[model samples]
Target: MYLVGKFEHSVNAVQLSALLDITYKTAWRMLNKIRSVLSMESQQIWGEYIEVKHEIFNQQALLSDDRLQKERSVAIIKSVKRDENNCSSSFFAFQLLSRRKQAREVLEHSEQAEILIRLNLGGHSSVDMNPRFQQFQKRNTAGDLVNSGKRTCHPLSVIASNAFSWMKDKFHGIGDKYAQQYMDEYCLRLNASTGAITCAFEHTASLSLQMKH
Candidate 1:
């Protein structure tokens, strides 16, 4: 629970092992179990006005084939809400995309009928895009396909950049297989409030009991 509360600061298995006087393997397993639980908790359907940005992570690719094998595609989703005072707040979620799926599934199955999608059409030419996503780009030629050059300093972008940097600095770098779990952990920490740690502790304890039974 302590380690999960400090997720925003980045905690690795090595550090947890040293702190708990346990083997690295045990610490790693414990950490991943927590991440897996958080990932399950993050699967809620999002509605209302949401912004989706497709980004390529891990390695830079100069060619299409290299991108398919070496890089990972992720959708950074930001859902905005307003209070009675008209102050805006945002919550974020991430979905790792496979080469065959791309953002087509996300667009097609969205709960909202009119969603505002903002694509960062910068260095993503090498990505193996879904045919439907390509058609979406072609159909929405009225300024929906945003150029990366006109980027603004949005909070969502900052959170995404920080997540990459945190993983690099702490875990050195994560593989594509476990990337979604790490992203889930990051989003959990980002969206957590003051009482969130207590809630996490209760939830973890419940899960532990269920597993034992």
Candidate 2:
């Protein structure tokens, strides 16, 4: 609770152990179990106009050759009704994909038209631009739609940048296996918006209660 909610940060086993006056193994087990409850598994997300972005990060390991590179994709979905009111409420989904095939499969599963993709100027776009996906009509000009004299508004890109910055500032760096858990935590924060710290505490406590029963 203190490490995750109070500090709004992530700590490795050793750091957690020292902070909590517990053994390293005990801290590791505790953190992993808590992360399990926060996992966003099998959730379905849909949107009329969606923004998708991908970023790759490198994590360090003990051995010189043990470093690994991982890619994460973020999709921000805007609801049609909110767009009409000029107040867009964004819903997001995230996946940790290491291969192009995995990335393609996830995008196919979402399957929304009027999609705005944000990529580095020369970066590889793993999204398949199939005619079928493009055929679906746009309900609102929401994501990435720039108005006259306004700079392009890529909401997902902003979200991704902030998310990555938060992770780095709080946790330093995360492992590939636990990457999704951190992403899920941030998504929960985004959804809650206000009173996010309280929301995180409530969520973890609720899941803990369920496990005991």
Clashes of 2: 0
Worst 10 residues of 1 by lDDT: 130-139
Global lDDT scores for all candidate models: 0.58, 0.50
Stretches of candidate 1 above 4 Å error? 42-47, 61-68, 82-88, 101-155, 193-213
| Backbone clash count for every predicted candidate, in the order shown | 0, 0
> 12-105 in candidate 1: lDDT tens per residue?
8998999899999999998998777655542222323556665555645355654546766566776555557776555566777655543233
Top-scoring candidate (TM-score): 1
Give the TM-score (vs. native) of candidate 1: 0.63
TM-score of each: 0.63, 0.55
Model 1 score (lDDT): 0.58
Largest lDDT belongs to which candidate? 1
Model 2 misplaced stretches (Cα beyond 4 Å): 10-14, 40-93, 101-153, 195-198, 211-213
What would the per-residue lDDT of candidate 2 be over residues 1-213, giving only the tens digit for each residue?
Answer: 445544445566788999889999999898877777765322223334433444333422342322332343334332221445566454554545445443323454333232332212122233323212111222334533333333543445566567767777777777667877777667666654533224556766776676778
| lDDT for model 2 | 0.50
